[model samples]
Target: IDAMLEGFEVSKENFSTNFNGELLIITITLLSFLGLYYSAEKLTSRTSLTVSSKPLAIGLMIAIGIGLHNLGEGLAIGAAIGLGQVALSTFLIVGFALHNTTEGIAIASPLAKTKSPISKIIILGLIAGSPAIFGTWIGGFFYSPYTAIVFLSIGAGAIFQVALIILKWLYQSEQKLVQASIVSGVGVGMLIMYLTSILV
Candidate 1:
């Protein structure tokens, strides 16, 4: 009977460890996607600088939506780290840093064609890109699954919202292909992260 009891206790400990590990992994994985979500926010705003009155309204809407989405990402990051998945969380940080660089360039490309002021471009870029830093710190500290999912859904929704803005901007224009390309570029960021997870 004592031996059986000892085995039961061992099983319980193992179960706890497995549960913790799974939680950590999911939290970190979710945080990785969260970082890209905010990075998209930063990148999308750069495309708004040359818009006319109507497009500017759309731009502002996109920016506001993306900002809220980014806040959600910050929460996910915090929740993930809080759960103790530091390594996976770090991987998210590194991947997002790399991904955001490309995103910055992609977002700025269309604006570059319009001869906008460098200051305006830089300001928009910084506005969009800086949230990654905040999100990273949050993911490194807070680690929670419920928080992560909440942010994930918000971020996903914001991206879809911005995609609509792109569609509107491209409608009935010679630049439709360019607009489509930009939308696809954003998806590329998502795809890259997904592929990286496979490597892990």
Candidate 2:
């Protein structure tokens, strides 16, 4: 496929596929939502700055989960670009960039409580997120089904583990109201997901 340089000029055929790549993309997207869910849960359950240290670790874990998912999304972007899917490439960049900004705040919130040195916090945040940059570059340069599948699966697994951790933390919380809210949020999120999956 010829490289597309202009808006609306990139053929959807070049960007769209029915094979492993598209499946991997969708899988990564769902997992990204899982990360978002965990992040919201953590923020609501406990503040990193004002809450217990136990939940602080959970918050960090959530950040890690988001980072991994973002890496897979980045890989999709790169892979699409590698295939000359310019419009898809642009979409991925914009979406991921916006997601990353929110992730930065989510990650920094808890770490801010530690009163940790700015240098250390910066390093940690970058460490958590740097993989996405490399993953995207690799996916964009080489079209490898095996690589994409492996990274996508790994990313999803990371997010899933964090979700489990969040559940456990919620279960252990002493406040009934907080626990109820967490349960309600998760129930609503899952219901919305079901409806959207069916409708979309």
Q: What tens digits encode model 1's per-residue C-alpha lDDT throughout 117-165?
A: 6676666566556665566566566534444444455455555555555
Tell me the whole-model lDDT of each prediction, alpha carbons only: 0.51, 0.59
lDDT of 1: 0.51
- Candidate maximizing lDDT: 2
Local error of candidate 2 at residue 16 (angstroms): 19
For model 2, residues 116-192, the per-residue Cα lDDT tens digits are 56775676577568888888898888746656565666576566655565556546654453567556855765664
Regions more than 4 Å wrong, model 2: 1-60, 169-200
Q: Total backbone clashes of model 2?
A: 1
Worst 10 contiguous positions by lDDT, candidate 1: 1-10
